[model samples]
Target chain A: MPGSTLLHIDGVEKRFGGFVAVDGLSLEVKAGEFFALLGPSGCGKTTLLRMLAGFETPDCGRILLDGTDIAGVLPHRRPVNMMFQSYALFPHLNVSDNIAFGLKRAGMARDEIATRVAEMIALGRLEGLERRKPNQLSGGQQQRVALARALALRPRLLLLDEPLGALDKKLRDSTQRELMDLQRRLGTSFIIVTHDQDEAMTMADRIGVMNHGRLVQVATPRQLYEQPASRWVAEFVGDVNIFEGRIERREDQRLVIACHNTGAIVAAAPRQSLAGEAVCVAIRPEKMKLSRQGPAEAAIQAGAINRLEGTVSNLGYLGDISSYGIALDAGATLRVSVTNTARVDVDDFRPGERVVVWFEPDDCVVLDP
Target chain B: MSTRQLFTRPARRAAIAPYLWMVLFFLLPFAFVAKIALSQSALAQPPYLPTFDLTAGWEALKAAAATLSLDNFRLIFSDELYANSYLRSLLVAATSTTLLLLLGYPVAYAIARLPERWQPIAMVLVIIPFWTSFLIRVYAWINILQHDGLLNQVLMALHVISAPLVWLSTDSAMYIGIIYSYLPFMILPLYASLAKLQPSLLEAAQDLGASPAKSFWLVTFPLSLPGVGAGVLLCFIPIVGEFVIPDLLAGSGDMMIGQTLWLEFFANKDWPLAAAIAVMLLGILLVPLLVYEHIQRRQLEGKQ
Candidate 1:
């Protein structure tokens, strides 16, 4: 690992008696990156975050921060701070005192502590309510107090465990933006743990998706969405139409796959080996276009657009886009999204209407079945 | 009245029953005591008839009052012997309460931190000592604190002590008995309050760069103050009136107000003076009770 790597978790594992909670997880966070550990519940995302915060010790790994092994370091001794999911603002302390708590613990002089606390209070936009206890503040204000308290220490790495999980929808959205902006302004690395895919997509520079105590994939949100590494990742990231198949022919960068259920030949990018082997072709909903008629140059070009005839089963109107669930002739349903441009009446397409769904060869990704 | 009005009567009566019970059980006894405190001593006796004569009651009050005559108050306070004993009792009780808090806090914290599966068992263990008789538990302390007692024997064998030290009939023995008798009172409430504390608060403290000790003092300790207040009041108020532990552990040396009241009533057979002393003790105990109630009420209002 490079010296600039802020956090290095190497082969970290945790077990509770007979069950493994975190199994041989290893990852690196750069100095100023907004990293996210994203997964569903019980996927070890929070457990990994706890280990990084020093609340949990890994059963079998070394955790390095700023190029030094911190496996045995206590949470208080570490140069990292955490913001809890509940925004664990001290109910007894007012906003200023709560933010000043960490500085006081560090034994800073009284004047310096006061100045820093005032600066943090202003930074959090809590200018006047310094003497109001946490119970008197709104949920968003309490969250800001929590943030100010954590940031007062100026830690090398900041860990947030579902920081926005407690807020209402509007507050959470705004706070998510504010947190990203704050991280950028401070140039501090943040490792946020969340189960919400949208939260991970909105704020993270890189996301590590975990499943059953294993890191399935770590990539940028766009990369994870567009080029999922496995069948699980493909289905997890977004709405995708997956067709189990075997590769029938191999071209330069594309493979002709014969889908098992639909019995249709489709062309996809050849990323994984599948010649005469079982595989699955995954195409995003927005990548597939629904047309009333087939394309004109369908069969002539190499890797031509594959067409599937299907009747619309369900239509979802989402203001900006309309999603159509097309029940194909092979009995497998395929989702297709179309932008609602110019306030067109085409979004009112009902069920039982026959439509041809087509996607380019580059739009579909081939993975091992 | 309408049907709704008729139905509301029964609901209101049911709601008022608990308050009525409290008044009957608690306030009624205090009222009787107050009435007795105001009556003439002769009239306060059996076949009691309270005459509403201001002269006789006023005389009784004046006689009981400690003017330049520190005679009655001096009977308990002026003598260095009695004064030292009272001080010793207070010192013992205060020390025991402090020890109980120190020992009980970690036990409560440990029990609270235990997994849900283990919590009930831990709580049961803390409560199991209360099932035994308190007198028997105090007697058990006597057996352990005696000169040739198990503690001394073990310490002697370990060469920690050269001889069998005089452990019984000492202030230390009295403290041990008091703490052993009242420990469960401290632990249960502390455990209950500490158990309800959100674990996220501790995590938040750690994340905010607080060390474990600092976090505990700053967050956990202050949050559990209500329980501490409850435990201290429960232990202190009762122990302040305690006569049994001192009598059993300290022979004639550890005389307290309860023992003094007992001697004044039964030994001296001075009914008027005993009643006067009883009234004085009541006044002493009531002040703390009132202060505690006021504090508790203010706390409740703050919460609201």
Candidate 2:
């Protein structure tokens, strides 16, 4: 079950009047996988999730759950549950009753429903707050009750619509980890939609970056960060300095590009084919380093390495790293980050100081325009 | 300045204005009625014995109070006509309120679920009947309910009835008038509450595997209870003391308390006994309100 496809969305499209909310999007979610649909607001991540949960029917699509088309099934008749972003807990029901709602609806025996409610309450670590109404509980406790309620029926695939969106920063972090653990133990597939990139990276096994109602790229979080599919995907996932360039040379395992401002740049391996000479070379700030002088002459033999000479234009002393904005000679500004490895503020780089920024070729991502 | 002078003094006056108005208009009149209920009927101008004289001072007032007794109350309690009217008034009020709820709830729910642009227009339709004068509407109902009237003609045309049905001077006609008049009062509050309900709550219920009917019972109805209570109290209280429709439509076989009071006060000119009946009817109406308040307090206590 873990390896098999549980939910197969084939060319799902939803339109509101003239505006397309979900384009012709197709995807497969493996059973027991922690998948995240990551995007900005109104990017159709929420609309796609709603379609899976039977809240919205697609204009054209086949939603196959274990090889049965369930697109026309009523929401109450479907074996799917969604944890709403607002939690949407029944305000009148107490914690125990909220957890037992789905179970009782399924016509479970009274004793069995009580036992499942108790188990879910304990699973959420809400021991003493059983009788409290949803309004009476704190925000964190209310979220747990919502989660417990959604999980009560053991749905084939649980949908979470930004479930931790209401919690504060500190609670959000811990809850994310707890949610990961719970999903792993339950072994029920989960597809969580969120606009926060960090939350998806922290909890999802794989991430799908969506834009304009279509999935731009889907990959493991590390792959999405280290090897993005396009310039937009690279820039959207994390902070990156993208330089306009054209392919200068192509080899078996590596390619070299000549940037208009920074000059020649070599990439060890490019994921996409050389669709055109015009492309974007992207590098994360932390992957490159800064120093007062250039590297030793032995580095010149390695043709894939890059070296840029610039004066530091701006510097930010964050607690863990110092970011330097370099004003390149050709008028292109590049951002480079250096990790703070020493206790004291040593290796001080300040604004208006001359510096050499350098990085290896593999640290760079070659993205198509 | 202190809080009392700067803040609370003005605020306190504004808050006390309604109570002061009630004391002058309501409590004082009730006191006069209570006095009349206790006094004996008389052949004099005021129709009650031992009227207090201000010029005669404290001694005369004391003598007037001593003459007041519970004799009118005893007489009304012993009479079958008064007893039957009270029961009939309560039963008609309760049944009409129930019918209003059953008929009005779905219409309110539909209006609330309408698109935002249509809701205000639909609500105006509900309130439009109130523009016509109430007496004119009741008179129109008389025409519709009479023999060979519009209702019988329609029924005959549809072949639903073999002949003209006897509708006038019956409980059915009385209920029809009361419900038609009070439907707006029932619908407005129910719509207000139902519209305030989050659409997501119903979706959440369905996602949790509740069928449409079950979701209404579990989520929609429970949350709209405050509206139900308000609507019930609003329509039931006034309908219990209703006079116009009942007197115009209901048969002479049974009478409501309002008819009894009118007859006792105007026909027989027994002001003391009529006042006593009015006081007792008010006491009976207070029972439901007291019960509603008790339940409200217990719910609050349960929450805390």
Candidate 3:
């Protein structure tokens, strides 16, 4: 159901004093799409979310909701709602009353408001806590109340700022699952702001990675991880071994880089114009196979030439996977992870073992400097 | 110890020294006042009849107690002057407290919203008047409100008035004096409450589609009720029993209860009637205090 642009932020900029919180940021969210603004803290993701929720106005540019620029509109008048990170439920109001606040403000009929509040209460699984104030509820219950209150109005767009930040791990997982299910069911366009990459990768239909108040790249989670737009995005999204090098040659949909760390690296599916001399070859930790023998003997894809010889310097056994820090003879350290197929630690590489690490050219992302 | 006893220990362990002081200073004096209120005024050193010493025998104490009656209270009820003064005092207290609230809430809110470093400075400005003698400040108001004073001169120079306004010895002067002296009392508690209000709550209300005014009334105002209750009580109780401001600044046409009580005690030397009036005023004041206490307890219970 993701069709057409539901919201467009065109070169929006916000500044507090002289510090640019959000600088010339542009994005488009599709209708019924779960969009996440992913970044580190102080990356202006929350600021952009605040602007969408009408708590702030951009110093320049436009925020269009359904093609209507809503700069002059007040927050209460805008068809946008937000679930705050603090889950700012009204402490004075009971659960039902908190959920009914927006409906009441919209001047809905009393009976209709009551019905909507009851539905929300049922949705939040707060059946018997209708008359309990926010302070009386647990953290999860308060989070539910915040969600019910914001969703009660049925706004066009719902902005959530780190909605699961206050929850414990178990609650966070269940809440994330429930949120994804609820979004798919309601088909409401949600733009959630979070610094947690895992939450973004799992829940978002499209993730926009922000850095220094700018959108570095916006793509699907898989695309972002596999082919990041730059070395920063490549390193920021996930753990990757970036070999800084110069582009030596460009063949048909293929390129070779003379790396400073691991020497020449052949990469495939070279999408960008191979115009820049300096570039970085980004390879995911799991893409490379490690073996005491060669790549073919290790059951890796045949004819793979992105190979290097290194000694295992460090080993991390994370129960499900074993990660190895390999120090190449050329003096570069690369982290490689392999799935622990056997339960009793069979065929696992150890520290100080000399190993051959190799990956196919397709697994390598050639990014411009 | 049992859980019940453990839970009850704090209340039971409340410092006994304060209670002892209260007995020596407040309770004992109040008991003497009540005894005098029930007795008849006489042309004696202490000015009340049927007085008994604690060292006296029980028979003597009983004889004195038998002579004590409700005649003072009966006289106060029958007299129109005391009733009228009581009503005037209540009206003044109510109206002045309303004015104080209207002026103080916004100032307190502004101070609370100031920058972090400036908040204490703003609070200091609000309480700066406390550094001066309250009597001197009220006396300063006397100079300002009197004929040919600074206020009238400024007004006349601005051509806002043709003649000097009769500000002194009027209800307006009395109210001005009361408000000036009690403004800090109204603002301090209000500021404390307002400053503690989280900014996220207001933003949440706005985010949830409540307008600025709606958010204030719905979230901000209701949350600050404790401060409102405290400020109202702090201003209302003393203003109702106020004697100095009305005696100094108000006209003699209508007397407040404080003035009437003072006249009865000092000029007329009717100590019994004055004691009865003081007890009645305290009774009236206690009504609001008890109501406030009940609300405070209910608020605490609601939190739990």
Candidate closest to the true structure, highest TM-score? 2
Better by DockQ, candidate 3 or 2: 3
lDDT of each: 0.81, 0.91, 0.90
lDDT of 1 by residue, A1-369 (tens): 223788888999998788788999899899899999998899988988888888888899999987799988888778899888888888877788889888988889999999999889888999998988888788899899888898999987888989988889999999999999999999989999999999999999999999989999999999999989888998988899999987777777667788976665566556555444788888999998888886766452544778888899999889899999899997788889988886645546679988888778878888887
Model 3 fnat value: 0.82
Clashes of each: 0, 0, 0
Off by over 4 Å in 2: A248-256, A260-264, A297-304, A311-318, A346-348, B1-25, B43-56, B302-304
Question: What TM value does model 2 have?
Answer: 0.93
* Candidate closer to the true structure by TM-score (higher is better), 2 or 3: 2
lDDT of candidate 1 over B181-225, digit per residue (tens)? 888889888998899888888877776667788889999999998
| Regions more than 4 Å wrong, model 1 | A1-4, A272-276, A297-303, A342-347, B1-18, B43-92, B113-119, B141-170, B266-279, B294-304
Q: What is the fnat of model 2 with respect to the true interface contacts?
A: 0.76
Residue B36 of model 2 has an lDDT of: 91
Model 2, span A1-369: residue lDDT tens: 579999899999999999998899999999999999999999999999988888899999899999999888989998989999999999888999999999988999999998899899999999999999988889999999999999999998999999999999999999999999999999989999999999999999999999989999999999999988888888899899999888888877777888989878887767567577888889999998788877775785666568888889898889898888999876679998888889965868878988888888889888776
Q: Considering only N, C-alpha and C atoms within 3 Å, which residue pairs clash in candidate 1?
A: none
Q: Which one is best on lDDT?
A: 2
What ranking of all candidate models by DockQ puts the best one first? 3, 2, 1
Local accuracy of candidate 3 as per-residue lDDT tens digits, B232-268: 9999999999999988888889999999999999999
What is candidate 3's lDDT per residue for A1-369, written digit by digit as tens?
469899999999999999999999999899999999999999999998988888889999999999899965788889999999999888888999899888988899999998999999888899999999888899999999899888999987999999999999899999999999989988899999998899999899999999989999999999999979888999899899989898788777677788998888888856766456888888999999898875665443343477899999999999898999999998899999999988874977778999999888999998876
